[model samples]
Target: MQELTTLKLIERISTLLRAEQRKKYSALGLQPVHIQTLDYLASCNRFSDTPAAVTDYLGLTKGTVSQTLQVLERKGYLEKQQDAADKRSVHLKILAPGQKLLKSITPFDVFIKAEQAIANKQFDSITAALYEALVALQNVNGTSSFGQCKNCITFSEENDHYYCLLMQQPLDQADIEKICREFISVTNSGLV
Candidate 1:
């Protein structure tokens, strides 16, 4: 038997997931982009919740992301909060309604069932392989990894507390778990 190319495997999985997402979100007057935006906002760290970050993450034009954000805000899916320290920068906060909608539409059950069907060792192996592939692509594309803070090179644990050496700031549990735009994976050593 022959192995499928990485691109083929990734694309096929993406197409299937996208089709399901489109079907699930369409009933709620949401496009895949909208659902995608909500999902990103839900998982991103505070520093990565801005519209500019969203634009970068989605690889969409600023205008397009801005419009999508405005629509979500107007429809009660999210809110734009002015940054306390930066007068010009804004943060996108996913509201309760958005969370509810996302929960209702997400096919978590499908993923749970899939996970249950797979052997534990096989699941772990597949996850590791996929992560390596993702990191490789991100490196080749020169894109931000958006990895969890705990997995970043800048992440430091002192005693019982967490700190970000890059930002010279303390990090909470929530901060360590969420995706950070400035994440530099620990695997990429020899950096400042």
Candidate 2:
């Protein structure tokens, strides 16, 4: 019998994950795209929360993002606030309802079995390997990694204060944990 390629195994896993998410979304009367948008909003930093950023990250058209955002706003899941520093730019902030909904919908039920079955050491190793592979793919594709601020090339920690040279701003704990659209790989930046 022929062995399965690594790509096939990865695709199968992704398929199952999406199938499970679809089931959940169906039951909750939600579209996968809407839930996905909400999820991204929940995990993304301020720098990545605008409609333009969402469109870029989701690889969707501006009109599509605009329409979906309108639906989400009508559903009271999020709010659009004009940027204080930039009037032309708007920010999307997930409200309490969206946060609560995401909490209930997430934890990705499809991974429960695998997550429970994996040994801690093996899990860590696999996670690290997958992340490395993802980074390589993103590099080849010329796409932003959308990684945590702490992992970005411009991130700097000085005397317990976190700062981003690219943004010219200080980062709080939340900002450091949230994904940033401007993220650049530390190694790729030739700084490490």
Query: Largest TM-score belongs to which candidate?
Result: 2
Q: For each candidate in the order shown, give its overall lDDT on alpha carbons.
A: 0.75, 0.75
List model 2 lDDT by residue over 72-152, tens digit each: 899899999999999999999999999999989877643554454332433234445445444544444355566678878
Clashing pairs in 2: none
Instruction: Work out the TM-score per prediction.
Output: 0.58, 0.59
**Residue 16 in model 2: lDDT:** 52
Worst lDDT run of 10 residues, candidate 1, spans 115-124
Candidate 1 residue-wise lDDT, 86-129, digit = tens? 89999999999999988887664444444443324332345455
Report clash pairs, candidate 1. none
- List runs of model 2 lying over 4 Å from the truth: 120-192
